[model samples]
Target chain A: MKTIFIGAGNVAWHLAMLFFKNKNVQITHIWSRNKENAELLKDKLDKNIEIYHSLDSLDFSKTDADLAILSIADGAFESVLSKLILPKNCILAHTSGAQPMEILKLANYNSIKNIGVFYPLQTFSKAKEVDFSSIPFCIEANNKEIEEKLTSLANQFSQKVFQVSSKDRSILHVAAVFVCNFSNYLWTISETILKEKNLPFDMMKPLLEETLQKALEINPSNAQTGPAIRNDEKVIEKHLNMIEEMNLNSNFSRIYKLMTESIQQK
Target chain B: MKTIFIGAGNVAWHLAMLFFKNKNVQITHIWSRNKENAELLKDKLDKNIEIYHSLDSLDFSKTDADLAILSIADGAFESVLSKLILPKNCILAHTSGAQPMEILKLANYNSIKNIGVFYPLQTFSKAKEVDFSSIPFCIEANNKEIEEKLTSLANQFSQKVFQVSSKDRSILHVAAVFVCNFSNYLWTISETILKEKNLPFDMMKPLLEETLQKALEINPSNAQTGPAIRNDEKVIEKHLNMIEEMNLNSNFSRIYKLMTESIQQK
Candidate 1:
């Protein structure tokens, strides 16, 4: 399978590298809004591959690439699609969890017959190496043929792949925000609280690890335990007072109160 | 070493079981306000163990126990201490994370020479079994002899033990609420969101596991990702709107907004 990458961001970099190492998949072309980023990604791949600084300069009709993956930001979908001209037979997919498949069908880009979404449901960072096999891939396509192609490609790298609809994917994205992003913010708050007292953040690591493990093994709601779930008002009031006494952010107290109430509501 | 347990709650149950397995420690006596609970705990341990139904009936001065562990709730500490009497040489300790060591210095209980704290820093559930080796035991005592005895006992069961001060332990407890309790509540929120959409929460297992792994590998402040950190107003607005559309708990949106603001503030 021949593929072209439409962005050189974190998602694109990781996907391109994964595909580049696969003998069956060939990354033929790449482009990004930033020329340096495009070049940086190209340097990581085969030198023989073509790097396009501007999408308008690349002639999609003349290329034989089977797929064009738009791994750009959510806001860039409409603008990127307007300028992107693709071969009628080539499959076009965006690697976004929030956007729908209809977003790929821009007014000028209707000539592109195939449209799909190939979302790798995991957080990506340039500094960290991810194990592609463990990451779940959520595939959504306008039609069966395009879906098969995307699923087959994802199967080559990942062990878990599912055909999720645009609606379900959006819901999954919301939940992902809670588990990944919001929980991470709570972790950041914990780190700050410890820092103020000269306590090493490392002390919380063992508990953090066990919390996740228990949540996964048993359902999170069933596994929940604390002063909040126990409804120990004395401990709750003491913690709230301590947070205020320490001169921490007011948001910390709000979060603590809200989370405690939520846990009790269940 | 001989030990007496003042409460037969989760902490007492787990600790008694652990000490029962160790040859160096022996649980000589057990008591709870509810005699049934004390009997339930006694059944789990050796049949020769003595059970005290009321603190008033037990003659503490006549018992040969060297240590008495007050593993009751924070609210119950004062009432339980008022009725309880201990031998002159017996060390009195509570397995609490929030209360200060000075809390053990009750007016009538001042006759007791030694007081200490043995707080196992982990969330315990009756249904789940925990590995004692990994749990960090925070030990605090009024004097060196009692501190050494508690430290030696904790060392027998756990690989990690620290002499945390009362001020530091209280700070640690607050930090723990964020990382363990608060983070777990966010997980419960995620589960609720997915369930409302008829989506399997199991689908999120991979992402949930990786989020913790990433936070621990890279500092959570630095590991932060998602729309909030990106200041992606488009995605944030869409997620907030979606949360309202789902008719989920209003607290979810409040938590969402507060956490997003907290992340960006840093």
Candidate 2:
């Protein structure tokens, strides 16, 4: 199996690396807006690798790929899809959990016959390394052929693979935002709170690890503690008084109230 | 120092075991509304250990030499604080992040000038064992003498101790809700999404653990990922369509947008 990667961000870079590691698979081409990033894969792998700075310069038929994989931002997927000119039978795949395959079935998919999604349901950072085997890849397709090909590709990189419906993937992405992105936002808030107190976040890390570790061992509903669930109005009142020491007002207050109300629902 | 543990929930149970393990301290009493829970602690420790459903059963003045530490829920803390009868000049403390020392003021002092907090900032589940040594215990007091006494008590359980202001501890508790409780809520949502998709959440656990592990090594702002932060509207639209299929309304939808907007702000 041969793959041509699009984009050079965290997912692109990591996915590209995984493809390079597979003995049977060949990573034939990579294209990114930043030439530096585009060459990153070419420089790290075999010297004969093809690098394209823009989709316009590429001859899709000559790229010699079984698939053209999109690993760019969600907003950018359409632009690349609109401009791509691939062989009639080549598979066009994007690694986005939130994007459904119907988006690829537009009137513009002139030459490409097979289109699908190869979304990985996890957060990825460029500086940090990802173990592809550990990440869940959500694969989807408009037809069985594309689905089978994408499933095979996904299996090469990870043992955890699923042919999730677009509806399920969309809901999964929403839930992913809550679990991965929004949760990180909460961590950001925690770090800021600790910083204002002249307290290092390191002190809270072990507590943070234990918090996650506990949830892994028990249901989150069972793991819940703190003023909100306990309905410690006195303590909640005290904490609010202290937070007023800061000059900022944000949706944070609304979030706290809403979540508290939610926790209290039971 | 000989001590009396005033509750036997997750926190108290884990703590009693730790204190019992330490050669320096003895847990003389464990109070629990659940007699079985109290008996379980007694079963695991010295047979002479006293189990009480209420503080009224123990004449606190003659009970122990060092301290009477309360580790119940917040609403229960003040009631026990008001009712406890203790030795003159003995340290009386409660393990709560948000409660102020003033609750133990002139009423329950027993002529003992010492009163404080020995709060471990983490979530605890009864079924899951916790490594108390790594958990950070925040200590606050009415005065330096109480601070010293509470610090010694905290040191018996955890190596990391901080002399935090009640203001800081309260803020820390608020922050703890974000990092611990809110994080677990995210996991719950993830599990819900997976259940809807007929996918195993076990597939996502390794990634979830990796997400948390990376969080400890890097700031969450830098660790941010997903379609929203990447500003991938096509992907977002696709996910939205999927959500409609699942019949989930706009509550989580608004949260998705709100959190995405917040992530972009970072």
Candidate 3:
């Protein structure tokens, strides 16, 4: 598979490097809104790969690349698509969890036949190494042929791949926010609270890890514990009072109360 | 050191087992309001150990127990302490994150010389095996003598032990709820949302693990990601709409909004 990579952010950097390592995939070109970022990504790959400063400047006719993977921000999808021109038969795919595969149809070159989504359902950081084999790849395409192509390509790197719809992909993205983003925010809050008391946040690490492991082993709902689930009103009241007394962010009290009620309601 | 174990709940079960395993510590007596539970706990240890149905029946004077560990519920503390009698020299302690060591002063046996707190900062499920070596043991006492005794006892099983104050211990408890209990609830919400879409929750495991690993390595505030941190109103609105469209729990939308606002404010 000959591919052109767009975007030089975390997701793009990881995916481009993965593609470069796979013997079956050849990353022939790279592009990003920021030329320096594009150069940075190019530096990580074979030196022969061409770097394009703008989507329009890339001559799709010259490379014969079979696929173009756009790993840009969700807000950039429409604008990037509107300006991007691709070969009539080349596959165009966006690696976004929130955006629909049909969004790829907005590419300026209307004749482009295969537009799809190659969404890798995992958090990525350029500085951290990711084990791609276990990450779920949510693949969606305009038709069976495109779907098979994308799934086959994804299978080369990941053991888990699914033909998830745009609607379900969006739903998964929301769930991801809750589990990954929101839970992380809660962890940040815990760290802040511990810091205020001159306590090391490290004290919570074992419990945090055990909570996650237990939640995975037994469904999370069944693994619930603490004052909220136990309905220990006295402890809850004490905590609320402590939050107020400490003059911590009002959100701390609010979240504590809301989460407690939610847990009890469940 | 000879010890008397009180309560038969999760905390009591784990602590008794740990004390039983340590060659330096001998669990001479066990008591719980529920005789059946006390018997069950006793069965897990040497058959020679005594099980008392009531705290009043446990002759602390005869047992030569230097340490009496109360692992009962917070609500039971006052009632238990009001009726409990301990030897003058026995160290009386309670293993609770929310309760203060001073609460042990309520013991009817006023001559008791030592009162302290032995709070293992981790969640325990009776069936789950815990690694005591890494668990943070937060010890608090009325004086230095009792502090060293409690610290030395805790050190028998755990490498991490701290002389935390009652005030700081309660603060740590609140923080523990956010990081462990509350975060697990968010994970439960994610599982529910994914289940509604006929998607396997397994798809989220890698991302959830990575999110936690990242938060621990980098400060969680710095590890924050997704629409909230990006301040991407479009994606946030889309997620909120989808949550409503799915007719999911009302708390889902409320939490999503609150957590998003909190992340952005941070």
Candidate 1's displacement at residue B63, Å, is: 1.2
- Over B171-231, each residue of candidate 1 has an lDDT whose tens digit, in order, gives 9998998999888888888899999989988988888888888888897887887888878
Give the candidate order by descending DockQ.
1, 3, 2
DockQ of each: 0.81, 0.61, 0.75
Alpha-carbon TM-score of each model against the true structure: 0.96, 0.90, 0.94
- Write model 2 residue lDDT over A132-248, tens digit each, in one string: 786788889879988998899789888888888887776666666666777777788778777777777787788778877776777454677767777877766665666566644
lDDT of 2 by residue, B145-173 (tens): 88887788778778898888876777777
TM-score of 3: 0.94
In terms of lDDT, the poorest run of 10 residues in model 1 chain B is B104-113
Candidate with more favorable, higher DockQ: 1 or 2: 1
Q: Is model 3 an incorrect, acceptable, medium or high docking prediction?
A: medium
Regions more than 4 Å wrong, model 2: A107-110, A142-148, B33-37, B141-153, B234-251
Clash number for every model? 0, 4, 0
Residue A165, model 3: Cα distance from true site in angstroms: 2.2
lDDT of candidate 3 over A1-266, digit per residue (tens): 89999788889999999999889899988888889988988888989988887757745655688999998888887777777777778998999889988877777656578889999998877667788999999999988999999999999999999999998899899999998999989998899988887888888898888888887778787788898877888899999999888887999999999999999998
How many clashing pairs in candidate 3?
0
Q: Looking at every candidate separately, what fraction of the true A–B Cα contacts under 8 Å does it contain?
A: 0.80, 0.65, 0.76
Worst 10 residues of 2 chain B by lDDT: B248-257
Tens-digit lDDT string for candidate 1 (A53-98): 6757546667888889989888777777777887768898989889
Chain B alone, TM-score of each model? 0.94, 0.90, 0.93
